[model samples]
Each structure stands twice: as C-alpha cells, then as structure tokens.
Target: MASATRAGHRWLKWVGFLCVLCAIAFAVVWYARNANGNEPALNTVAVSRGDIQNLVSATGVLEPSNYVDVGAQVSGQLELIHVRVGQPVSTGDLLAEIDPTVYVAKVDATRAQLKNQQAQLADRKAQLRLAEIQFQRQQNLWREDATTRESLQTSEASLASARAQLAMLEAQIEQTSSTLRAEEANLGYARIYAPMDGTVVSIEARQGQTLNASQTAPLLMRIANLSTMRVRAQVSEADVGKLQAGMRVYFTTLGDAEHKLYGELQYIEPTPEVTNNVVLYNALFTVDNQEGRLLPQMTAQVFFIQEEALDVLRVPVSAVARNQVKVLDAKGQPQIRAIETGISNRVYVEVRSGLNEGDQVVLANRDPRAGQGESRAAFRGMLR
Candidate 1:
C-alpha cells in the first residue's frame, strides 16, 4: 500500500509539471504576437518647396472711362427730342430742340432795327451831299460878291449839321448791327447738339419739358463711352498701401454674380476719401468691353493679385504639426524638426524650410473599424 501511494504522488507531480510548461509556451507565443503590433495608421503627405504668391481682395463699382453731362444752354419749351436714351450719337448730332419762334422773332426785330438804322444813315449821307453842294456854291458866290456873309454862314452850318447827322446814324447802325448778331446767336442756341461722340446714357428733358438755364445749365442728359469701362474700387486703408499700378485684377458685377472680367490696375488716388470719419482710397482699373456687357454703376467684387506661385509642393495647413514636425531620421527613427512657413491662403501653407523633397509628413489618423481584430490586437499590444 505505501509503494502504490508513492507512485500516485509521482504521477500527480508529473501532470502539474506538464501544465506549467504548456502555460509557459502559450505566454511565449502571445508575447511574440504582441511584440509585432500593427504599424501606426496615419495619413501622410510628401513635402516639397516651391514659389508662392499672396493676394488681397476688395469690392468696388464699375464706371465709364469718360462721361459728359449734356445740358441745355437756352431756356425754352423742348419742341422735339431727336434721340432716345442709350442711343449712340456723334458730335453735332441734334439731341433736342427748343422752340425757336421767340428767338427767331427777336432776331428779326433786331435785324429790322439794324436795317432801319442803315436806311437813316443813307438818308443822312444824301442830305450831306446836297448840303455840301450848296456850301460850295455859296462859297463861290461869296468870292464873286454874289451872296451875303449870312448866306455863306447858313450854308456852312447846314453842311456841318449834315456831317454830324451822318456820323450819328453810322454809330447807330454799328450798335444795331451788334444787337442783331447777338440775337441771331441766341436763335442758333435753340438747337441742341451732342458735344461728344458717345452713347446717350440719360435724357433729363422730354418732349415739351421747359428748361431753365438762368441759374444752372439744367442737365438735359448724360453721355458716356461704353466700349471701355473703368472699375473704381474703394480699397480699405489696410490693403490700399499694397496696391500699385500694373497689378493684375479681376472683378465680378452685382448682377446675378454671373460673369467675371479681368483688367490691369491703372491708377491709385493719392488722397484718401473721408466720409463719416472713415477713410478709403480709390483704386482704378480698366477692362475692355468689346462684348458691351458691362454697365455703369455696377457693383464689383475686386481681387488684386499681389503674388502667385505655380506647380509647387503643397500641404493642408492642418497637417503641419504645431511647433514641430516629426519626420524619419537617417537611422529610420522619428525625429522632431523645426520649420519655417510662407504664404498661406488659409487652406494650405507653403513650407519654406526644414523639409525635403518627397519627405513624408504625418497627418491625422482615422479610427479603426469595429471588425478590425488585428488592429485591436495591435492597439492592445501598444498599450501594454
């Protein structure tokens, strides 16, 4: 019985030893699997350096390069309107006409007065000729003792009076002629004509409208050249300093936000406009309108191309690590790097320094899927 009990104890000890060995083998395999955790699931981008440019944006209005205010020089009832609004006209094209009857009557009356003065002058000259002949005959009679001293004096007085009368009439003729010419000029002013070669943008006077030119010329209409347009952009004081002539610009009108037009900066006003205590500078640009699509006073959104870059390495601004970037070192281990940045359009920042061509820059990591058992195992190993 003692021998049998000793054999059972030895068998129990062997079984316990086998169980411990199995546990040790399982732990070795588990550790080996855990040690090879899945690589970090990260998004990366290649870094490269290249040129970049900056820009500033603003808003403005479109206007004509040249505009004119067509006005009435004479006050009268508008008898007729020869042109309609937006009609193209050339210089000397009759735009409108005031009733010329009154002016014409005045001219006729002044001309009649001038003719009357001329007739009186002619009559006076005839009388002078008769008086001169009598004076010469009287002088001959006095020399021959056939006339008295009183007769000779009377003839001389008549001659002098006739000469004085002729002088007065001639002076009257000159004065009346001047008045007639002035009246004729006033009559001519009744016809209104275009002063420039452009389109009639507006018509302030309609048929039968009375114009008052006693004080102001009474703006009858406005004319503008639409072939070329100007964009007068009021830039903020902050961005105005960077604006210069010859810069590239583009703008879109307020109409449906539909079309975009390109132009070059032509001028920048040296003085700033102050309204309600706010200061703004005026920047002007020119755009061709061969299509005639642009109109006056159209609000425009403007962009000034201050700088630009083409075909360069770029990355999302969010991918750039704050204060550092971790990159693989020469030994293939992660190393922290300092970098300098350049122009950013708020979406991407130009990496100007501390990176190389085709270098991988780490971005954000996404969450693993629910069924990613291998990934979970890797994650657990990393935590351990």
Candidate 2:
C-alpha cells in the first residue's frame, strides 16, 4: 500500500511539470507571432525633386543637308579627274575633263560649215548688186529706145532671182550660226566644272574610263555641303504620331556618344518603309556642323524629347503600381494611396500630386526575419 501511494504521487508530480512546460511553450509562440506581425515588410525609396524627361529613342544615319551627284553630260573617255575624294571645291572650279578631242572636232567642223555658208552669202550679195545695176541700165536704154523691152524684162527677172538667191543664202547662214553655237556648247560640256561649293564626297568615274551619256548622265562624282547635317531617323510606326515638325530633338554618334548634336524635328516622311513586315517611318532633323565633325552615312542614336518636368517631385517608376503607391505614413505605418503622375520615362515617374518630397514609397515587401521566424512560430503553435 505504501509503494502504490508513492507511485501515484510521482505520476502527479510528472504531470504538473509537463503542464508548466506546455504553458511556457505557448507563451513563447504567442510572443513571436504578435511581435513579428507588428513589424513592416517592405523596401522603400524617397520621393525627391529632380528633372524628368520623356524621350523617344531611335537609330538614324547622318546625311548632308545639301548634296548633289555630279555627272558627265557628254559621252567620251574620262581623261582627267581634277579633284580627289574629300577635296574641297569652289563653284566653277574644274572637277574633271572628258576627252575633248571629239567635241573639239565637232566644233571645228561646225565652224567650217558656218564659214562656207557666210562665203556663199557674200557671193550672192555681189551678184544681186550686179543684177540691180544691169536692170537700171537696161531701163535707161529702153527709155532712150536703145534696147528692146524684152532685154529690160530679162534684167528685171535676173534682179528678182538674185534677191531671192541672196535671201536663201542668208537664211542658210543663220541656221549654220545656230548649229555652231550648239556645237561650241557641247565642246564646253567636255570640261566638267563644280556646280556648287562643297566637298567631294565620292568619285565614281576613274581616269581612262569610258562614259556613255546617250541614255543617262553618267555619274562622275558626288559633292555635298557638310556644314550642316541631317539625321534620318527610322522611327517605329507606334511612335510616329507623337513626333511633329519643330519638335525638340538631339542625337549622338556612335563615336561620340557623350556629346550631343541638337536640332529640331524638320520633317517626317509620309511613306513608311516595310522591312520583314515591320513598318518604320523616317524622321529628319538638321544640325549645324560648322566644325565639320559630322560626316555622311554615320550612325546616330537619336532622342526625341516629348515632355519634360524640371525640379519636380518624382519617384522610381517601380514604386508606383497602377497609379497607386504604398508609402510609410508619419506614424511609420504602411498605407496605400492614389497618386497623380505627369510624365515618365522607363526609370522614373513625375509625381504631380499625392506625394511630397522626402516621402518614402515602398517598392517591394522584403523582411528576412519575418519569413523564417513567423513560419517557425506558426508550426510551434500548431504543435501546442
């Protein structure tokens, strides 16, 4: 009976100890859950005053503002090329010369023909003068009854025929003079002259090359005014509507990306080019290149500034979700608030209202301690 009583006492003591442990475990789990639940889980950024710009980007090529293809007007062997590639030329400066031998020969032949016509005209005029003198003398003789009326009529006929012959020769001479002028002009075409002041950008015709101008004018060289450059930007069809003439724009070459060349949007081509079924429209803008740094056919990264806000309260674009922001209030509590935004680029957004400078906006929820600690606490509570 004594052993039974002691065994019952020991079992009761063990049960009481287990009950105390259970209470301690429950208290720890409750504290963990309550403490971690009160903590915020988020990363934040401050809204600050800065400049923001909305820009459209596209790739383009640099082209001369004014350029021309110099070609040969007459067919002959290209004998001399006076200007080389990259040489600067002035107006009326000799650019090249085709073989003038054929053209010169044609001019000489025309001149000879004109001279022959003029000589024939001079002879016809002399004969006309003689016919007039004879007609007058025969009339005097007929009045004195010293010559027959038939002789007088013959003199008059001779005079009229001589005048007609002289008129015909004069007409022939005038026609030959015109032909001579045309042949001389063709001879001048043999010597190519610079039509404008520019730099020679290309030379297509080589010395000793034969040119055929019968069908089309054979290109000899290319001249361009490099003082100004036009950027031909290929903008996507989606962004074409936002662009217009005189819009603010700038560009940078691949070689010098840090330095930008500024200009206004000058034109947008009405036609769109389709490549691989992707439509693209061309936009042009001009930039002054008085220093001659810009060149033809250079690749440019163009930026069209659509809208800009200066010294405005802005936040990272990622912080705003659907025009709503999660921000930490003055009491350090997270609150969801609607915000009014103006212009935005890919990286930042301009906050027009509902957010102040130095305010903290949440980007994401990130709490390392809450994840593991809360999970363990929940598991412990389940066990209890």
Candidate 3:
C-alpha cells in the first residue's frame, strides 16, 4: 500500500510541474506578441509644390507721414481759433488768431518813428542844400573880393557839418525802417496760418488763453497729412540686420485685420532703444491712406517679408534637420539627402534643390500600432 501511495504522489507532482510549465509558456507568448506589436515605425510627409514666405513680425504704431506742431511765435491773448480739430486746412489758410491789439499798436508806433526819421532826414537834406549854396556864394564873393577869407572858411565848415548831420540822419532812417519791418512781421504772426495742407489733429491752446512766447514758442495746435501713413515698427536688434531700405512689407491694424496695407521699408534707425535690457530698433515704412481709413497712433501688426518662394517644391520644416532631409528613395529606404533651402515660414520650408515634388520625406518617427499595444498593455496592467 505504501509503495502504491508513493507512486501516486510522484505522478501528482509531475502533473503540477507540467501545469507550471504551461503557465510560464503562456506568459512568454503574450509578452513576446505585445513587445513585437509595440515596435515603432518612421513617419513621413510628401514634398509638394507650394508657396512659402519668410517674414519677421512686429508690433508698431501708425503715424502720419508728414506732421507739424503749429505754435504761437508772439505772445498775446488767443482771440480766435479758425480751424477746429478734424478740420481740413490748405496752405496759408488761417488757423488761429491772437489779440492783434498789441502787435498793431507796435506796428503803428514803429511806422510813426520811421516817418519821423524820414522827415528829419528831409530837413537835414534841406539844411545841407542851404549850406552848400551859402558855401558856393561865399566862395564867389571871396573870389570877387566882396567877402572876407574868414567868412568863406566859416561857410565851408558849416557845409561840412551839415553834410555830416545829413549822413547821420540817413543812417537813423535806415535803422528805423528795419525796426518797422520787424514790427510788421510780428503783426503778421498774430494771425497764424497753416504751413501746409493737412487736417488739424490737436488743439493745445484755447480761445482767451494768454500765451507767453518770451522763451519758447507756445504750442497752439498740430496738423497731420493723413493722405499717407507711416508705421514705426520696433524690431529686435537681432532681426534688424536682415532689414534693408526698400524691402517689401505689409501691415494690418487691429481695427482692420482683414485688409492689409503694403509699403516699402523706408528706413531703419541706426540707434537702438533699450527696454529691460533688450535692444530694439525702429523700422519705418509708409503706406497710402487716401481713404482716410488709417489714423495716427493706430496699433498695427507688421510683417517684414525677408524672402518668398511661389509654386516651389516645399516640405514640412520638421523634415529638414541641420540642412539635410531624411528622404524615402525609390526603394522605400530612409536615406539622408543634403538639400538647399530658400525660405521657411516656420511650418513649410522651400526646397531649393536636391528634391522633387513627389518625393517623400520623413517628418518624424511615429508608430500607430505601438500606441495600440501600449494601450492594451496598460489595460492588462490595470486588470492585474
């Protein structure tokens, strides 16, 4: 009985060992299948003909191409403002007026002084003529032996003195005339006129306000020619070197993003502005505003087109790495190909050479099947 029991126990142990081996085999097969399924493959995109533009973006403010701050040159009470803000004015049009009372009185006084000097000059000339006649008569009398030598000498001395007085009066008249002209100019300043054709954009002085222009000219108003607008774009110092005068640029205002206004780069300021340790330079461009749509101080999103390519072979920028691209050749094998690129817009890069429109380029390495396997493995882990 003992021998039979021992044999039966040994058979039961063998059966348990076989069951363990089966379980181990099943686990190995499951793991191998999942591991094989999780292997990744290369992802790719096709090269195609498309347009790409390389641009530098910046924010800027719009301003008038031509603007001026009209000021009062002479001090007086601001009597009238001929043009209101937003009013269109032509050159020489009256813009404002100061009280002409003081200027007119000054002009009158200067004119009177000038006239007095002229009358004095005429009197001096009359006296000079009389003296010359007396001197000549005295000389003739002396030659005829009718006058004494002393009398002739006295007459000559008197003539010389009269001539000197006349010369002095003439100089005085010239000085007075210059003063009169200056007073007249000041009188004209009381009536301020527009220096150019534009619209009044600002008014700094009000009627009845007293202006003291003894030191600095008092600002009265500002005029802006809205026919053309300029955008002052601040670009980073790093990008400023790429900008050049006459390069094509376009901008859109916050209010009118649908419409784009184009212009050429007019200038790039040599000096840079530093803000928070970052340097920026101002780039200027002008655009026509005939429709009066563009206004001063309007914020704009500016684009400087550095380069562009149209209907050229292009591919995903991600496909190009370090001036080379991983391309799938005719044999469907990945190979590195050196390529020349022209313009890139962050997403698409223009292929200048060494690539064809129908060729495929590897953008990234991705495996959709591996993702599924990972999901299944995660599920199995959660079940465990």
Candidate 4:
C-alpha cells in the first residue's frame, strides 16, 4: 500500500509541473504576439512620386487691412449717435453729434464782437480823414500867415494821432475776425461725419455721454474696411532670418482645413519682442476678404513656404541611413546605392538623383536567419 501511494503522489507532482509549463508558454506566446504588433515593420517600401514642401510655421492674428478710429474733435455732450456698431456708412455720412449749443453761442458772440470792432474801425477812418482835412487847411492858413504856427502844429499832431488810432482799431478788428472763424469751425465739428466709407466696428461714447477732449481727442467709435484683411504673424528669431518680403505664404483659421488664404509677405518688423526669454518678430501680409468671412482678432496658423517639389520621387527618411540606401537588385539581392537628396521636412525627403521609381528600398534587414535570432532574443527578454 505504501509503494502504490508513492507512485500516485509522484504522478500528481508531474501533472502539476506540466500545468505550470503550459501557463508560462501561453504567456510567452501572448507577449511575443503583442510585441510584434506594437512595433512598426519598416522592412521595405517602394519609391513613389509625391509632393513635398519645406515650410516655416508660425502663429498670427487677423485684422482689417484698413481701419480708422473716429474721434471727437471738439468736446461736448454727445447728444445723438446716428450710427451704431456694425452699421455701414459712407464718406461724409453723419456718425454722431455733440451738443452744439455752446459752440453756436461762441460763434454768435465772436461774430458780434467782430462786427463791433469793424464799426469802430470805420469810425476811426472817418476821424482820420477829418483830421487830414483840418491839417491841410491849417497848413494853408499858416503859409498865408492867417493862423498861428501853434495852431498848425496842433493840427499836424491830431492828424498823426488819428492815423495811429485807425491802425490800432484795424488790428483789433482783424483779431476778432480770426476768432469768429475759429468758433465757426468748432460749431461745424460738433456734427461728426465719417472720414471714410466702412462699417462701424465699435462705439466708445454713448448718446447723452459727456466727452472731454482737452488733452486728447476722445474716441467716439471705430470704423474698418472689412473687404480686406491683414495678417500679423509672429515668427521666432531663429526663423525670422529665413523669411523675406514677397515670399509666398498662406494661413488658415482654427479647425478650418478647407480654405487656405494666400498672400505674399509684405514686411518684417525691425524691432523684436521678447517674451519668456524668446525673441519674436512680426511679419505682415494682406489678403482679400471681400466675402467678409475673416474677422478682426482671429487666430491663424501661418505657413511660409521655403521649398517645394511636386510629382517627385520621395522616400521615408528612415529608409536612408548614412546618406546611402539599400536597394534590391534584379537578382533579389540587397545592394547599397548612393542617393542625392533635396528639400526635406523631417518626415519625407525629396529624391534628386536616386534609384528609379518603384525601386524597392530596404528599411530593415529581413533575413530568415537574422529574423529567427532576433525573435529568439525578444522571447528570452520577455521571459526574463
């Protein structure tokens, strides 16, 4: 009975050992399958014709190409606003009106003062004429010995004084006339008119609001020509040197992949803006926005084209190692080929002088013996 029990116990131990081995084999097989699936099999690829472009990317903002701020030239109470935000206006169209009561009163007072000065000037002229006549008569009487020399001298002094008084009155009248003209201009300024044909984009002053334009012209509203848009792109200093005026550039709005707005680089600002220890420069360009789809302050993704090749033979960058590519010859044998490359954007490279199209380029060695060895090594690593 003890010998039979020992045999059964040994049999049960073998079964348990076999189960453990099966579990380990299952896990190893699963791990090997997953490892193969996770990695890319860049074994070989055919040289194909495609488009390649080297571009410099930057972020930008959209704004109206032509915009103006309409401000109050004369300070007064804003009595009426004829235009609202987003309203279309023409040149010379009434935009807003300030209280014209004070300006009108000033103009009337200046006119009255100017008229009074003018009357005084006329009276002075009459008095001068009379004095001249008296002086002439006195000179004749003195020459004839009919009047005293003292009387002739007094007449001459009166004539001189009258001329001086007339001259002073004329100057005062000229000054008053100038004041009248200024007051008239101020009164006209109370009625604000659009300087250009555009749409009113903003309003800073509301009706019945008091505006003080003593130091600076108070902004009443803003007008913009939305038919055209300007783009201001901020490019890093490192990339700014690569750009130039008249370079072909394009941009798109966020999530707008269908439309591409193209324009030539117009200018690059000389001053650099430093932010977060990084220097950036602004690049400006304009595009037609007649449809009014582009708005002010919209963010854009800008791309400046540096180089481009269309319908050219290209290959993945990984396929070429050490400036040499492994190509499969007619005999199905791997051979090293020298290749001349062109513009590249890090993903694909333009093939300038390379093997013919449809030529198979080897990315990785796929020899059966080598593959078996690699698989064995990967399996052992997983087990460890």
Candidate 5:
C-alpha cells in the first residue's frame, strides 16, 4: 500500500508541472500575435505651392511722429490757458498768456523815449537848415567883400557845430527806436502761441504759476499730432540686419484688441542700444490713425516682415529629415533628396532649391507600424 501511494504522489506532481509549462507557452504565443496590432500609421500632408512669409515678432511703443514742447520765452505769472489738454490747435493759436502788465509798461517807456528822441531830431533838422542858410549868406557876403573874413569864419564854425549836434540827435533817435523794437518783441512773447498744428498732450504750467526764462525755457505744454503715429520697435542686433527700409511690416496695439496696423519700414538706427547686457537696434514705421484709436506711448506688438514667397513649394518643417526630404520616387519607392532651404521662422522652413509642388514629403513617424509605440514607451521611461 505504501509503494502504491508514493507512485501516485510523484505522478500528480509531474502532471502539475506539465500543465504550468503549457500555460506559459500559450501566453507567449498570444502576446506575439497582438503586440503592435492596434496603432495607426502617420498622417502626411503633400507639399503644395502657396505663399510663405518669414516674419520676426517684437514689441514696441506708439509715439507721435512729431512732438514739440511749448515753452515760456519770457518770464511772468501765467494768467490764462487758452487751450486745454487734448484740444486741437492750429499754428499761431493762443496756447497760454503770461501776465503782460510789466512787459507792456516796458514797451510804453521805450516808445515814449523813442518819441522824445524823434521830436528832438525834428528840432535838430530845423536848426541844421537855418545854419545852412546862414553859412550860404555869409559866403555870398564874403565873396562880395561886404563881410569881414573873421565874421565869415565865425559863421562857418557856427554852421559846422549845429550840423554836428543834429547828427548826434539823429543817432540817439535810431538807438531809441531799436530799444523800442526789442521791448515790443518781449511783450509779444508774454502771450504764448502754438508753434505747430497739433493737439495739446500735456500741460506743465498751471494758472497763476510763475515761469522763469532766465536760464532754459520753462516747459509750458506739449503738442503732438495724433492723426499719424510712429512705432519705434527694438529689433535684436542679430535680426536687425534682416530689416531694411521700405520692407512691409504689421503691428497690433495692446489697446486695439482686434485690429492690426500695416506699414512699411521707415528708418533704422545705425547705432544700437546696449541695456542689461543685451543689444538692440531701433526700427521705425508709421501707421495712419484716421479713426483716432491709437494714442501716444501705447504698447504695440510688432512684426518685421523680412521675406515672402508666393506660390512656392512648401512643406511642414518636420517633413524634412536631416535637411533632406524623403519622398516616393517615380517608381513608388521611398527615396531621399537634398534640398536648399530659404528663410525660416523656425516653424516652416522654405524649400528653395529642391522638390516641386505636388511632391509628397513624409512627416515624422506617426505610423503605428514604424515602432513608434516602442519609441513612446522608451520616451516615457526616460521621463520617469
């Protein structure tokens, strides 16, 4: 009975081992058949002829094309402000007025002095005429031997002295007239006038404020033309070389959420600005604002349109492998071809010398059969 029991136990153990082996083989075969069956192939787009533009983006500010600071030319208390901030003014429009009482008085005094000198000059002219007549009569008498030589000499000397006095009086009148003109000019400066046609943007001088013009002219107000504005964009020194005058550009202001302004490049600064270890060059362009939407100092988002290709062959940048594009040859076989690329904004690299429109370029592996699943798994593992 013991021998029979031992044989049965050994046999049951062998049977159990064989069943585990069969189960392992079945699992291996199942995994081999289903491992990569459920993934889709890559999606590709055909290269087509279309317009491609290379652009550089930057930020800038909108400023007036021309702005001038209206300043006080004469010193006095500000009595009146004829224009308010944002008021449109024409050239010679009254901007402000300084207290002109003192200047007017100075002008009056100078005019009185001038008038007095003029009256004196008239009297001198009369004296000169009388002296000329006397001298002529004395000369006639002397010629006729009726007057003594000494008397004739005395008359000539008197005439010469009167002429000298009259000339001196005339010089004094001229000096007084110059002084009067200067005083009048000063009086005119007391009333400030707009130097250009623009809108008042700033008012630094207040009513009753005293301005001192002994040194620099004190700022009174600022006038700017808002109908047209300029955008001063800073392009990096590296990219500035690509920008040139007359190139087209577009910009959007932060305030104008939906509108974009287009313009041509106007100017480029030869010098670069170095700030915080970065160098940038200034680029300028003008935008028309007939709608009166743009304001001075408003931030603008700028784009420099460097190059544009129209109706040209273009493919996704990723479609190019190793700077070489892979496409199906005439025989429907995979082949690689070298291509020359043009300006790229890093998103779409333009194919300049290779491939034509309607050619198919293979994009990166989206194909499930191309071992992408394993690649993705490896990538995920690396991330962890």
Candidate 6:
C-alpha cells in the first residue's frame, strides 16, 4: 500500500512539472509577441553632399550647322559627277559638269552675231564719215557759190540718214552685246562649282542624266559643313514652356550613350509639329563637332537642364516624406524633423535644410531581433 501511494505521488509530481513547463512556454511566447517584436528594423542612409540636376528629357536629331543644295542653274545632260557622296570639297571646287555642247553652240552663235554687228557698225561709221565729208564739201561749195543749193540740200539729207543708220547700228550692237553676255553666263553655268567648304552629302543627279532647270533648279547634290552640328530636339508641349533661350543642354547618340555632347539652347521655333495627335515643339541648339563624330540626321537623346545644385547636401527621395524626414540621433534613435528640399531628379533630392552632413537618415524602422529569435512557423503559430 505504501508503494502504491509513492507511485501516485510520483505521478502527481510529473503532472505538476508538465503544467509548470506549459506555463513557462506560454509566458515566453506572450512576452515575445508583446515586446515590440513585430516592428521592422530601421533602414538608414547617411546625408552627404552630391550633385543634382532637374532636367527635362526629349528626343532630337543631329544636322549640320551649315548646308546647301548644289543644283543645276542651266539645263543640259549631266556629263560628269566629279564628286562622290561624302567627298570633301572647298569653295570654287568644280563639283560636276553638264554637257556643255548646247551651251557652247549658243555662245558661238551669239559671239558670231556680235561680230557681225561690229562689222555692220564699222560699215555704218564709214558711210557716216563719207556723208559728213561730202556735206562739208557741199557747204564749202555753196559758200563759194560753186555748187547749187539743191545739191547741198541733198548732201545734208544724206548726212542725217547716215547718222540715223549709225545710231540704229549702235543700238543693235548694244543689244547683241547684252545677249552675248547672257549666253556666256549660261555656258559658264554648265560647269558646277562648290559655293562653300563642305562635304558632299548626297548626289541626286547621275552621270549622263538629263536636267531641265527651266522651271526649277535641278538638285544635283547636297553639301554640308560637318565641323559643327545643330541639334533639333522635339520638346513636348507640356515641357516646352519650361525651356528658354540660352539654357544649357546636352545629348547622347543611341550608339554612344555614355558620351555626352553639350551645347546651349539657341532658339525655340514658334510653330509646333502635330504628329499622331501629339503636339511637339522644336528646340534648337548647336554643338561643336571638331572631332567630326556627329553626322547628319543622327538621333539624339537630349536633356534640358532646368536647375542644378552641385556639391550640396542630398538624400534619396525615399528618405524624404511630406517635407519632413526621420533622422537618427547620435544614439541611433529616429526623430522626425521638418526639411526643405531644392532640386529633385526623382531619384535624389537636394537637402536644402534640416539635415546635416553625415547624419543618419532612417528610411524606415523594424525590429532587428525579430528574425533571429523565432522560426517563421513558431512565430506564425504564436500569432494564431
């Protein structure tokens, strides 16, 4: 009977021990849940000085700063194309030639007519000289009463006819000379020359191609100076108002995104281009292309800088909320403070005030010990 009582006492002791263990486990879980356990750890960043820019983005095309279309001023068959596409040329360089056979023949005909007019003028002058001499002789004879009045009168009429004939010949010679000059000019136009220093960008006329410049000058080729390039950026209507003349801008080519070519805004066209129901304005700028890297009609990714702050206090945009920021004190405790921001690039913002250099800005807060102390399943079960 004593042995049975001792077994019962041992059973009770085991039960009590199990109850105590259950109470201890419950207490631990309750403490873990109530002791700021669910709070997230603090993510922080240091306030530092950096560069920031407020920019407007747009697309553009590169074109030569100066360009001209070389055309045929007079009509003829294209005899030669002295330059190929991309050939370099200077002013007065012979670019090409039209078949000058017709022009040459016209010039020859005009020249021969001019010579004929000169011969006629010479013959008329000789006749006028003879008439004047005879009239003088008649006057002298009349004064001496050695010639009849009728004969003197006839001589005077002859002199006047000769003078009229000479004047007519002179007018005809002048008209012929003017015609000759025009024909000579046409002959010269058969040979085309570069009017400016540039590279031949295009050739519209080929060898032996017939060109008729009567109505419009036939486009023979195009020449452009590639030493400087102009960027024509298409700015959206919403952003075009923010742009102004003489502002700084830069661009990058699709093939070379890493390298930026910069320039100042030159002009903004008053007209807008309506494409696919989108209104876009043209903003122009020029960039020095001494390296000859830019080409005509190349695309550019452009940025127009509105405002910029250099070597200024800055922080990530996420760190600032509602013109206020949470900064960690020296003791690593977060405290909210009102802030003033200047320029923002959507990624980083300029910290105008309320944040000191090297100050820790708390992005957010969390419990650092939450993950370490409990398994995911245990924490979940405790919550349930």
Give stretches of model 5 more than 4 Å off. 1-39, 46-50, 311-313, 322-344, 349-362, 366-384
Candidate 5 achieves a global lDDT of 0.85
How much does candidate 5 score in TM-score? 0.79
Q: What does each candidate score in C-alpha RMSD? A: 10.0, 6.8, 6.9, 5.3, 6.1, 6.2
For 1-384, candidate 5 gives per-residue lDDT tens digits of: 999999999999899888767766775675566675533433557777776788888778999998899999899899999989999999999989999999999999988888888888888889888888988999999999999999888888989999899889888888888888888998999988999998999999899999899999999999998989999999997888888899999998776657878999999989988999899889999999877788998999998888887766788888887779888677655578899987655657778878887787778765545664686577557434
Name the top TM-score candidate.
6
Give the Cα error of residue 194 in candidate 3, in Å: 0.4
Relative to the true structure, how large is the alpha-carbon lDDT of every model? Answer: 0.82, 0.91, 0.90, 0.89, 0.85, 0.90
Per-residue lDDT tens digits for candidate 2, residues 228-301, read 88899999999999998988998899899899788999899999999999999999988999999999999999
Q: Per-residue lDDT for 109-225 in model 3, tens only?
A: 988988888888889999999999999999899989999999999999999999999999888888888988888999999999999999999999999999999999999999999
Residue pairs with backbone overlap in model 5: 41-367, 42-366, 42-367
The runs of at least 3 residues in candidate 2 whose Cα sits more than 4 Å from the true structure, single-residue gaps closed, are 1-47, 139-147, 319-341, 352-374, 377-384
**Residues 187-253, model 4: lDDT tens digits:** 9999999999898999988899999989999999999999989999999999998899989999999
Cα-based TM-score, every candidate: 0.68, 0.79, 0.79, 0.80, 0.79, 0.84
Q: Put down candidate 6 lDDT per residue, 33-147, tens digits, no spaces.
A: 8575455557999999988988999999999999999889999899888889999999999999988898899889988998998998899999999999999999999999999
Of 3 and 4, the candidate ahead on TM-score is 4
Give lDDT: candidate 2, residue 181. Answer: 88
| Candidate 1: tens digits of C-alpha lDDT, residues 91-207 | 999888899999999998998888888888888999999999999999999999999999999999999999999998888888888888888887888888888888988888779
